[model samples]
Target chain A: MDAVLEADGLGKRYGNRWALRDCTFSLPEGQVAALVGPNGAGKSTLLHLAVGLLRPDDGSVRVLGQQPYDNVAVLPDLGFVAQDTPLYRDFTAAELVTMGGKLNRARWDASVARNRLAQLGIAPHQRVGTLSGGQRAQVALALALSKRPRLLLLDEPVASLDPLARHEFLQALMGSVAETGTTVLLSSHLLSDLERVCDHLVLLETAKVRLTGSVDDLLGTHRQLIGARHDGSAIPGVAAVIRESHTDRQSTLLVRVDGWVDETRWTSTEVGLEDLILGYLGDHRRQGSHAAWGVTA
Target chain B: MVIEFVLDGRSKVNTYMQLVQQVRQALRVGLLESGDQLPKVRDVAQALAINPNTVLKAYRQLEMEGLAEGRPGVGTFVTGTLAGASLMHQAELRADLVGWLRRAQTAGLTADDIVALVDTTIRATLADDVIVVTHT
Candidate 1:
């Protein structure tokens, strides 16, 4: 299956520091995938590369089966909505959506845009700056939807909306994608939203892909085993210890083991998405202990 | 058609799941039954001040679980059954209970304590009158 978006050895640098380094992942067509990372983990950089907004210092990116930079063909089929949701502050919601139609070659239906805006309860004539944060997000979404693109890229699209509006926007976005079979790459800080909407995930930390796979597979492979640490030398095959809670009698460990736990060795338990993220972040912290301790390498 | 929904800000559950669970709870309590039409995704989004996507997700989950169906030209409506199987409904619920039991075990709660908690909670909930808000 051809990926709607693919990154090959993607890296970005600013001066001597790498915002993102050696990152590579691909998003399949017609599926929703999320890029998750802490601040400055290069989620934006990766998103930019995916959308062709920024060229990578190393490697390449393909959007809709073609290179994104200077590629007009991909532009018509892809819609990139940035985190800030850039808009003409002076223009009304309707006016800005109309302007988008004029600026982009992709055919946009004015009535559809109007209906979507009205559905969001955002007045079409209301100035962009005058709308509430949630309403502004709705207008931005309306603009993206109006484009009728086959591939949708959203960065922190629901960051500013209230709980209710966030749900509404995501539902509409999902429905639109479902209806058009649009491949969507959405980045958000909220894991629960992604959990509900996305089947695939890319876990990023330290400017690299820490783990990438379907959510089910990732969860299936990682588990927490509670048992007595009988011997101090080593726990046979546990690759890394995420966390440990112990007493004189029993020791429980959260480990990222490659295989299943033998029931006799320890009681195995499933870990939630949040637990996985905590473990991944803990790994990054341990690996970067030098930076934490302020040692300039 | 007017779409009615209830928002509970107190629950620890994520807002999106809370909304979906509320719709499901409503269904369980007979507030929304088969053939009942849901409000437009946007309307519920706007009225509740949530992102449309979140509501869409709830609706999507509802649709996936067979609680709702989305008709492209018209709108989403309550479905006849949850995914499938009328006879296995109680069995599925029991499986969910077992999953919760495992979680409770992880938390160091005994089976007796779990049963007591459930009984008490069920009794308390049965004591309260249903709160239904109809919006047009």
Candidate 2:
């Protein structure tokens, strides 16, 4: 499969602290991959490295099979919307789209951006700063899509917007993806929102890549078992125990299973993306030891 | 009216599975029938603000199950039904079930308790088919 983004042994540091370390993952093209983790977990750092904002300290990063930073060819194919949705406050929405057209030499469709803003009910003549957070986001997204980039990278674009605005923004985004088949990698703390929009997931924890896989594959392979209290060692066909909790009478275990289990003794139930991601995040917090579980990158 | 699909993202069920089950349930209840057009993938994706690929996957699963078919340049249409009994028979059964449910509610049975009772009874009836044998 052609990967939209790939990283191998990627690491970044600020002063003595490492923001991201040994993060290696590949996202297949045409997938809306979610970059998720708690704060200070390097979600921003990874996205920055991919879009050429920051250079890696240890290993290589590739976007569309080419180095991102300072590469003219790769830069044209990438569109980035930062956390702030940075735009010239004084510029009208129309002027911003015009500026985006002038900036990208490869391909620019001014009407696409203009039409997008119009559809969002954002007046073309209104100053960007005067627009609400959501409208500002739509303008930023319009500018990005105007360039016709093959890959779009977003960093918490909806964190400040209200619920309705968030819905409108995502609806516009999904419509764009449906039309152009653009591969998107968006970093967000909103797990439920991610659950709605992302097909692939990359979970970071304490500056390391903890989990990365398609949402369907991940959910299908992991199971939640509710059974009588006993040592979990005897559970057959288990890959790794992601989380476990118990009472005197019964035990609940979240395990990644490679094959079928005896369903009669233990009620094996499927897990959703949020539960699967939370189980991994919670396990990392409770144990503080990834080594004990033997989770491979 | 077309059957409206709702997905609970927080539930243990996968989103695609939820969609597939909803379509099947709609078919069983006679809300959706053969030749009925399902919503376009993009329309559902935008309406629900979900990933388009998720909608595609669910539609594909439905196609695989022979419950729906997608025609190129056209929309997906329901091609099969889960309705086993005649419509009149099913309607009569549903009416009786509703009456019983009302009586159960008056008897102070919560919705959860009613579901649990029905689920346990169904499982017990199905368990009779499993014949465990021991080798001497």
Candidate 3:
């Protein structure tokens, strides 16, 4: 099967400013991928392009083996919950679900939506405007899941939710993915949340992709070395120096390893997901350039 | 069955590694034994709110380490034990070790110092065995 989402040289511009430029990444099917980046790094722009909310100015994007926009068959297979989870304020939970069923036609599963709402403790008669933020988000998620989408694109769905609510929402989401094998591409600035749920990662910065890969593979290939740092010129297997800091007596280097290094020289420690992401983000910020650390593209 | 998996997301340790370590630790403490079925991947994933793939990877790692095995259409099961001694013997040894650790703590040894001491002792014993073999 092709990737769930694929982008090649994807770029999007607004007037003179480039919201996203030269972005390219392929998210494999059945993987929960975390799309993370700093504010204004085009995270949302990339997601918008993927879901066909906006078109790319330069390159092309494919969602589930077809162009996202204007494709009759593809639209039903793609579910999108925008950042605010835009829902009709006056519509009750049941009405919103009915609307979803009407909008999706044969594709919508009203029973699934209604059951999810009831399980989430959302009363069917309650107006969306009167629901709590978490309840509203749950209703939005129910609508999305009711479509039975093969690919679900979430944009900071839990950014405003409290910790417990966030946990509950993710629990529900993962349950659906497990049951239905839904491919999730969730964009969030919260690294901790991503760390818990994401097996794949894509890091964006300055409107470009800094890194993307399986989290396990990335963590296995990166190492933190704290020892006498002497320019790192003699390190034979260092793929890239992701980040480097020095003191008068010692040097710390975060390096992507392509092969074995002389372990006797430094204490090599394992790198975690958050540390790896922060290292790339910090490097991009300090250098103000897209230095692809371990990213071939 | 129904292993209560705990994950420390904030720790520097990789989550999968943490899972692998937990399974091994459980075996060592007799909490899990041979023929004990591990939770289904989806069940653990939903319970922890983590990706099912992560749970699958951890289970695969355990299988690689010869600690677990996955039966087709059936759930994964613990296949090997980490503890070398009999359960009664292990309990006695554990009690002695705990008593020794308490004494070491009372003697102003930090947790790091205790770990270092245990690690160095094990390494030194292995080195002695190697020297003995070479001389023989």
* The candidate that achieves the highest lDDT relative to the unseen native structure: 2
* lDDT (Cα, tens digit) per residue for candidate 1, span A213-267: 7666677677788887645545655666767767888877777777545779789
lDDT of 3 by residue, B1-136 (tens): 5468988865666667788999998998889999999988877887888888778889999999999999988889999999766775887888999999999999999999999999888877977777443444
Clash-forming residue pairs, model 3: none
Predicted candidate 2 versus true structure: per-residue lDDT over A1-297, tens digit per residue: 499899999999999999999999999989999999999999999999999989999898999889887777898889899998989999998888878878896898998898988888888789998989999999899899988888999999899999999999999999888778899999988888998899999999999999998988898799999998857575787788889999998989999999888887799988777888899999756644567778753
* lDDT scores in order: 0.76, 0.89, 0.88
- Candidate with top DockQ is 2
TM-score of 2: 0.83
Off by over 4 Å in 2: A232-234, A287-297, B1-4, B8-12, B25-33, B81-85, B88-136
lDDT of 3 at B21: 91
lDDT of 2 by residue, B1-136 (tens): 3977887855667777888999999998889999999988887887788899988999999999999999997989999998986875987888999999999999999999999999887777866787434459
TM-score of each: 0.69, 0.83, 0.84
For model 3 the local lDDT of residue A122 reads 86
Clashes of 3: 0
Whole-model lDDT, candidate 2? 0.89
Interface RMSD of 1: 6.2
lDDT of 3 by residue, A126-220 (tens): 99999988888889898999999999999999999999888988988988888888999999987888887998998998899999998878988
